[model samples]
Target: MDNVITVRDLRVLDGRKTLVGPVTFELPGGSTTGLCGPSGAGKSTVLRALVDLLPHGLTRDGDVEVQGQAIRYGKGDSALRSTVVLVPQTPVVFGGSILDNALFGLRHLVRASRAEMRDRVEQALREAGLWNEVSGRLDSPAQALSNGQRQRLCLARALALEPAALLLDEPTSALDERSRDTVEESVAALRGNRTVLLVSHDPAQVQRLCDRTVSLEHPETLALSAAAA
Candidate 1:
C-alpha cells in the first residue's frame, strides 16, 4: 500500500468545544512521519483518537482509515489497536520477568506453541535493539532494566504484534539524554521498515528521526468557523 493511514478533518471535542483539530494527514507505507506542535495542541490526544482510546467524556469526529479501511469513531477498539499500536511517553513494564513482559501482548494476539512464541519475542527484542543486552537475562525481573531498556522493551512488545502502523507519543521524552539517543537509534532503524507517526515537542529530534512532518497549530489558532464546518 502506498499509504498505510489516511486522516482527514480530524477533531477532538469536549462537549462541543473543539479541543484539537480539523487536522489532516496521510502516512505513506514504511515512512516515519512526525506529528508535532507546542503544548496544548493535542498532539497526544490525536493519537488516542486514532485508536478510539480517547478519555471519558471526550469524543472525536473525523475520517481515519487504516490500510484503506475506515474506522468509525468510538468503534475501533482492541482490533484496531492491534493493527495500529500506540506506544505512550512513559515506559510501562508489567510486573513479571523480562520474558513475560516481552510476550505480554503477543500471547493474546497470536496462537502458537511455546517455542514459536519465544522465537517471536526474540525477533522483536532484536528489532528493538535490545536482544544483545538482555539475551542472557531473559528470565530476570523486568523492573531491573534501566529506563532506556524499559522503553525499548516496550517497543519490542509493540513490535512483536507486527502492527501495520505505530503511533509513538513522545517515546523518549521521559528518558535521560543517553537513553534518548539509544531510543532514537532504535526508531531510526525502523525508518524504511515500519510506518510510524511520532508525536514530539522537539523539532530538532523530529528533524533527526522523521522522513517528513505534519505540524499542528495551537488549538486556539484554528478558526471557529472552520471547526464548526
Candidate 2:
C-alpha cells in the first residue's frame, strides 16, 4: 500500500524534556490508524510534530513525510498547514458565522470558483452532519453553537480545504456521547480517500476507528515491553 504519511525515528523535545522519541510508523492512504496511550503519553505531541506545529522552544528530529514528500521542519507554516490539518482536542472556532468559518480557508485560495466553494462548504457541513442544524442560520455567530456543533464546524472547516491527510488530536474528547458518535461516524465515512491519524486515549475508539493501532511508550518501557512480547 502507498503511504500517505510516514514517520521514521521521530523524536520531539520541549526544551530539555524529551516528549517522545525514536518512533516510526506509516499511515497508508485511504486508511485509519490510531495512536493510543495514557494521558501525557505524547499523543498530542505526535500530532503536532507531524504538522510542524511543535510548541515554542521545541525541536524535532527524524523524517515526516506526507504524500511521499518529506516535510521540511523549518519551512513556511502554510505549506505544512495546507497539506496536513490538525483538529485539536479543544476545537478553535473563529469569531464569525458558521458559514464564514467554513469558508475561511477557501476565500484565500483562487483554485475554486465561488459557486464551487459554496457547494463544497455545504457538502462538507452535511458530511460533518451539521448542515441541517445550521443550514438556516448561516449568518449566526459560530461561537453561539453548542460545543459539539463547534467541533463539527472545525471538522467542516478542515474538510473544506480538502486536505490529503487529517490529524485529529483527541477530537472527540470534549464531546458528549451523541456528539462523539457523530464525530466518529464522520471519521468512519472519511477513512477511505483521506489518510487519518487519530490520537485518542479511548481504547474502544481506537479499536473502532483504526485499522491498526500503535501503543506509544517511553523508550525504556517500550524496549522492555517488546522484549516481553
Candidate 3:
C-alpha cells in the first residue's frame, strides 16, 4: 500500500517553547492507524500541523508530504487540506438541514447541479453510516439530530470530499458507550478502503480500530517516538 501522508521529524513550537514532536510517521493508503499518547503530547497539534493549521505563534519544521507532494506552509495553503481532511473532535453543525450540512464544504469545492450534489451527499452519508438513519429525514434541521448523529454528519461531510487521508481527532471521546460503539462501527467499516489516522485516549478503541499504532512522546523525552507506525 502507498502512503498518503508522510512526516519526517515534524515539530511544533510556540515561540521558544517546544510544544510537540520531532514526531514522524506515515499513513498507509487503505488502512487505519491509531495515534495515542499521554495528554499534552501534541497528538492533535500534529494533525493541525499536517494541514498547515497550527495555532497562533506556533511554527513547525521538518517535512510533511501528501500524496508525494510536499505541503507548502506559507500562504495558508488549504489546497492540501482539501485533499487530506481533518475531522476535529467537536462536531460543528451550521444553520441548515442535515443534507445541507453534509453538502456544505463539498459544494464549495466542486461545481455540480443539485441532483448531482444530492447523489454525492447520499454516497457520503452511506459511507459515514448515517444514510439509513437520516435518509428519510435529510430535510430535518441539523440541530435536532443527536450528538452522535451530528458527529457522523461531520464525518459524512468529510467523506463527501473523497479525501486522500482522514485525520480523525478523538472521534468518539465525548460520546456515551452506545454512541461510541456506533461510531466505532462506522470507522471500522472504512478499513482497507480509506486511510484513517484516529487519535484516541482509549487504548482498547485504538487496538480494535487500528491496524498499527503510533505513539507520540512528550517533548521533554530524550527522543521522539520511534514506533514504525
Candidate with best lDDT: 1
Residue pairs in candidate 2 whose N, alpha carbon or C atoms collide under 3 angstroms: none
Clash-forming residue pairs, model 1: none
- Residue range 1-229, candidate 2, lDDT tens digits: 7988888888898776677877888888887778877887788888888887778899998888888888887876675686788888998998988889999877864378889999999988987889999999999999999888888898888888888888888889999998899888888888676778888888788777777766677322111122211
For residues 169-208, write the lDDT of model 1, one tens digit per residue: 9999999999999999999999889999899998788878
Per-candidate TM equals: 0.92, 0.89, 0.92
| Model 3 TM-score (2 dp) | 0.92
lDDT of each: 0.88, 0.81, 0.85
Candidate 2 residue 59 C-alpha distance from true site, Å = 0.4
Candidate 3 residue lDDT tens string, 1-229: 7888888888899887778878878888997888879988888998888877887789999998889988878675556656989999999899989989999977787667889888889999999999999999989999999889989999999998889999999999889888888899899999899999888998888878888778886322121233422
- TM for candidate 2 is 0.89
Q: Model 1: runs farther than 4 Å from truth?
A: 218-229
Give the candidate order by descending lDDT.
Answer: 1, 3, 2
Q: Which 10-residue window of candidate 2 scores lowest in summed lDDT?
A: 220-229
